[model samples]
Target: MTMIHAPSGPNLEQVRRIVTEIPGPRSRELAARRSSALPAGLVSGSDVYVRAAGGAVVVDVDGNSFIDFGSGIAVTTVGNSAPRVVERVIQQLDSFTHTCFLATPYELYLAVAEELNALTPGDHVKRTALFNTGSEAVENAVKYARAFTGRPSVVTFDHAFHGRTLMTMTMTAKNRPYKQSFGPFAPEVYRAPMPYPYRSPGGADEAFAQFELLVDNQLGADSIACVIVEPILGEGGVIVPPSGFLKRIADACRDRGIVFVADEVQTGIARTGAWFASEHEGIVPDLVVTAKGLAGGLPLGAVTGRAEIMDAAPTGGIGGTYSGNPVSCAAALAVLDTIREEGLIDRAQQIGSKMSSELNSIAAATEVIGDVRGRGAMIAIELVLPGTHIPDPDATARVNRYCQARGLLTLTAGTYGNVLRFLPPLSISDDLLAEGLGILRDAIAVL
Candidate 1:
């Protein structure tokens, strides 16, 4: 296995020289073209138009280097333009770009699936199907679950984000933006209150009760095919559910013959200090949805599950035209090799500890930081009114603007829109991470 090092070519100094302003003039021009050319629905957080990226810095079209804390919204774990990834992608391009697996199966696709089966939690014989996005993987998980169990209903947690596809949109809980006018969503999807320690009234016990009621009183355990949830809510504000929440959910799903689907889209591929978030609880979910970081920086998604369940769907019933594209598989293989060779999983743990301690210290100085919580490199700080815990979404907005102005890319999440999430590349330099945190602290001080 070869480790991916921050490329020596185009070093940080050269990167800065090329890109200087936040969304430099070229980026602004591109943004104007995008606004005129694309649909309004493809909204972006900031107008930082990127031209190139590697390690922890993204050089926008304008010639400025910004410490990327979002990782292109948690996609590029090994960092954009990871050496090994770029090399493999270039090699794949030389061979062939697209040979749809369903039409003409390829060895690389099977090799990628084999890697997923071996890496995903569980010693059981697992099967994997590759797709283009996290949403498609999630949607297929449900399809397999329903097909395997012959059950129609699926349960998802509140504040959960599955995808933009019709079935997944119904599974998603947020309404304002994701599901607003996309109603008439797929039927048979039910919502359960998430074990959000910050907002849940009676803690995990109450959440469990709600789950049981939804199963026994509303949908019935026998009728439900799967229980899907994000190990740590991603777009819902980097919320870490109670310690035993996942264990309880897994147990209930097991007893009821329902599949426990772990939506690890944003948390998978060593982002959470572990290969998979379920490892934190020592629980092996029936299905795991992986994407974002899986291919280093390529478009790849996967659903790895127990063989019996995965095989239930008839042959030719579950594949996509471009599922398991060869080039993405090559990139995924390099990603796996890079994580193992570079020891990134444990590094994520160390990075989380460093960030948590520093962020907590910063929080103590201000009353606006209502909560700071997360696992591994995936961390967040929720803003609130100084006296009351009422969400201060505006303050969060201000912090984002401030950070962007100072050559740092930050992201905001949470249902109430008051949370600032830090999804920096796991391989970010120590000085850069600390520097970004300092900038964050200074921004908070001014607010």
Candidate 2:
């Protein structure tokens, strides 16, 4: 298969040029309009309204260009308006927009499912179900797991972010924004200790032991349906579990007859130098949930797993009206094609190496940087008080503001809100990454 190279067009320069303040006059006007027109609950990290984005740079309405390190929160991994994805989506659109996959199934949907079944880890007989968002995929995975195991309790990790849906919000660990006032949540969802190397009371081994004990005593393996975890926690500060931690959990699930679900929403689709983050640990989870970067910029989510587990759901039990829309499926096929043909997995590794090196160098000099962690292109630095490991959310916000002011778009995440996570597109050029990293270094230096 031929690789789809980055599309070239006007204003696609891989350079940052700020013509106005971070939120220029035009953007300010848009923000004002947005405030009145939209709900106050929907908050945006940046005030700049984007006009166009491709490769590494995003151009705002006021003609300011900024290096994009967020990639629309890891949605546009192949870069915005990727040529292959656009072509496929347009072709599918011209053929048909939506017939409602449940009403009239289509070939594109089946094709995307087949691709996912083959691409995800584990060579066992696998099946896939599609949905419109990560939350839907995760919820459906739980449904299938519960149905297959005949259990009521589901286990999730501390600092794990599944989705915004009620059930997923219950699975998540953060309280201020995600969980505050959003109770009472779904029942039978238990939270366990995750192996966060930086903050764990003991180390990964002890964390694993405690997690196993929790499962055995508190939740009881016989009553558990599944254990859901992000191989690398994304919104919870890009926390990567220590080596062998994930495998140990998987083994525990296997020995207990519980379904092991790996939530690869943010770490899949070549964002983590692998098709799925579970591959890093050589663990074959019984069920895998994916979204975010699955369909370029279009919305698509998938649950791929062992055939018996997936088939546990009754007919008409796990579908939506717009599930596996043809247009999104076409985009997903193109994304998979692009990842394989363009060798983006290797590119992600290269990006991760470059980013980790630069960030570690900065951390060595900056006392506020408590830790530098993550794998592949999914990396982050946790900001803390100058002399202690106490979270410094203010410092994190200042760095984000500084980067945004200087034409570098960055994202901040963490359970404590003190982590600056980087998820730059694999399509970003080396020079553009260097420029963005330089801006980040300056932001940290001034702090």
Candidate 3:
């Protein structure tokens, strides 16, 4: 087991100049073809045609390279096109592609599950099931909780971004792009106001009261099966709940018979300075859903929980055709090994602290930056109209476009669409981080 602190790689400018026009002429043609072939429903990110990527820089098809602060929306925690990931993926592909864990059980899948059980929060004996996407994992978690608790409803917080599936969409707070035309969503999924201290009514006490009132007036404790929440609201402006909020929720769930399910899809797998963000509050959710960075860049999702509850589903009740695919499991194993070997959890904290400090300094110079909040590497600064809390979505959009033109990749989040989140890979270099922040500062100043 050799330890590796990410290797020295290509410089920022060298990587950017190679990928010329962001999307270049050839890339635009390919995108046009994609538009014809793929449905418009399948939305795509900014058309930065990618050729190759390594460390903090991604080279587009036009040979221009750009510093990646987005990490494909936090999917590539170990960095894009990592050599170790490439080699392992190629080796796994050569060995086999997919055997479908349900049809032919594989060692790697179970191994990954075992690893997740040990790694995720909780000391009790735990069980895990794998899936292909965060939506699937979230849906399965709800199913498992209901089956286990014999309850009818599940509660989710406002402004939370779970996934785009029917059940997950119902769980999510946004409606326009994600749920506008996709509805008539799954029933019995309830939404409660999340504890966003910056805008929450009366702070923690009122937020707790609202949660309790919701439980009392609408969805009672006995009728609820689970309360699914993100440890640190990822797409909800990278909002960090005030201290004791999660603990109180856990206590509420315990007092009743509800399962506490932590939707760690975006905040887990060392993205928030810990192996799992739930650990930050010393809270152990009865069930934990994880994905995104779990398998480095590979598509993998897991639902891990107490053994009895997770096993509540009847025989043949839960399983996917491609659940626990071997190749994905292999990649996940490598990702876990890499995180531990490289001490990425600690690095996430150090990097996030540095980033937050720098951003706060810049925020002091601007009236638009109404708030700076988040935990570990999952940080965001909400933009608002000067002297008011009105969300400045237009300013956010402008900042995003400016970043793209200047060779930096950043993403916007929050219900009001005014938060700029930074989810850079924990493995990103210090110099790259500084340069990306510099670009961001320039963009903000000009805006």
Q: What are the lDDT figures for the candidates, one per model?
A: 0.88, 0.91, 0.85
lDDT order, best first, reads 2, 1, 3
In the range 1-447, model 1's lDDT, one tens digit per residue, is: 222233341244322333345556776777888989999999999877765677888766565678889998888887777778888989999999997887778899889999999999989999999998999999999999999999999999988988899998899888979989878889899999887777663588988898999998899899999999999999999988888888999999999899999999999999999999889887799999999999987889999999999999987888788777889999999989989999999889988999999999999999999889999999999999996779999999999998988888899999999999999888788888888898899999999
Candidate 2 — which pairs collide? none
Report per-prediction Cα RMSD to one decimal. 3.9, 4.0, 4.3
Candidate 2 residue 64 C-alpha distance from true site, Å: 0.6
Q: Point to the candidate with the largest lDDT.
A: 2
Question: Which of 2 and 3 is ahead in TM-score?
Answer: 2
**Model 3 alpha-carbon drift over 4 Å, by segment:** 1-15, 18-23
Top candidate, metric TM-score = 2
Please give, for residues 351-424, the per-residue lDDT of candidate 3 as tens digits: 88999999999999999899988877888999999888889999999998888877888899899899999998
Q: Tens digits of per-residue lDDT for model 2 on 42-160?
A: 99999788877887788888778899999999999988778788888889889999999889888999999999999999989999999999999999999999999999999999998
